[model samples]
Target chain A: MAKAHVYITYKNGVLDPQGEAVKDALSSLGFQGVGDVRVGKYIEIEVEKSAPDEIRGEVEKMCQELLANPVIEDFRVEIPNGNNNPQPPKSEA
Target chain B: MAKAHVYITYKNGVLDPQGEAVKDALSSLGFQGVGDVRVGKYIEIEVEKSAPDEIRGEVEKMCQELLANPVIEDFRVEIPNGNNNPQPPKSEA
Candidate 1:
C-alpha cells in the first residue's frame, strides 16, 4: 500500500480569519509572545499498492481535480519511503 | 524569532466523515485505487524571539488551551531550527 500526506495552506496575501481568531483567543488566554497564526488542512491518503512515483502522480491529479482550490491555496505532497522500500531477496545457499 | 508548526489529527478509532466523503468523491470522479483517507488541521505560528525549546513549551500550552480538543484529537508540534541558527559575530579587523 502506498500512502500520501498532503498539506494545503493559504496563499500569503489571503486573509485567514480562522487563524486570526485563534491568535486573539490565545492572547485572551494569557499566552504571551504569540505572534501571527495561520491555519490549513492536512490530509493523509492510503491507496492500493503501486510504485511511489505512480502514486504521487495520481495524488497530484487528485489534488488538482478536487483536493485543493488553486485560486487561494497551495498544496504540497509528501510520500514516505519507508513502506515503499523494496525487501532484499533471500540468498540461495 | 522562533516558529512552530502544529499538526492536529484524529485519534485512532475515530470516525472521519470528511475523509470518507472525500474517498467517495474520488471514486465517483474516476480515480481508482484510493483507500483510507484522513483529514486534520495544520497550524503555523510565529512567536516573539525565543529559544526553540521555550517556544515549543509555549506552543504546547497554546494547543492544550485552545488549539486542539484532547478528547478525540491528537496534536504534534515541530519547531524548526532553521531560523534559530546562530550567526557568528564579525571580528573587528
Candidate 2:
C-alpha cells in the first residue's frame, strides 16, 4: 500500500470566492492577522502495491484528467516517507 | 515570512459530494483502479513574522473559527520545515 497526498489550487490570477469568504469570516472571528485566504482541494489516496514514483505519476494523471481543471487550477503531489506507509511517525528524528 | 499549509477534509461519516463527482469522473477517464475519492480543501498562508508553533496555533484557530466547519470537517496543518522558509529543497538529502 502507498499513500498519495494531492493538492489542487486555482490557477494564478483566478479569483477564489470560497477563499474570500473564508477570509472574511476569519476577520470577523478576531483572526485579524490573516490577509489573504486561498482555498483549494486536498486528496489522500491509498493505493495497493504501487511504488511511490508510479503512484505519483498515476495521481498526476488523475488530477489532470479529472480531479482538477488544468485550465484554471494548479495541483501538487506529496508521497510521505518516499514509501507506501502512511502511519509513520510525523517527526523525522 | 512564514508559510502555512492547511488541509480540511470532511469529518468521518459525512458525505462528500465533490469527492463523489471526482470519483465518477476518474472512472470515466480510465482510472479504473481508483476505488473511492474524498475531496477536501488545501490552504496556503504567507505570514509576515511568526514562529512555527505560534503560526500553527493561529492556523488551527483559523480552521476552527472559519476555514473549516468543525461540524462536518476535520483539518491538519503542515509547516514545511519547522521554519518560515518555503523555498527549501524538496529532498532532505
Best by lDDT: 1
| Clashing residue pairs found in predicted model 2 | none
Where does candidate 2 chain B have its weakest 10-residue lDDT segment?
B84-93
The residue-by-residue lDDT of candidate 1 on A28-81, one tens digit each, is: 998777888999999999988578777777887888888888778877777887
TM-score of model number 1: 0.85
Q: TM-score for every candidate vs. truth?
A: 0.85, 0.78
Please give the lDDT score for candidate 2: 0.72
How does chain B score by TM in each prediction? 0.83, 0.82
Off by over 4 Å in 2: A83-93, B83-93
DockQ of each: 0.62, 0.43
Q: Whole-model Cα lDDT per candidate?
A: 0.81, 0.72
Instruction: State how far residue A60 of model 1 sits from its true place (Å).
Output: 1.1
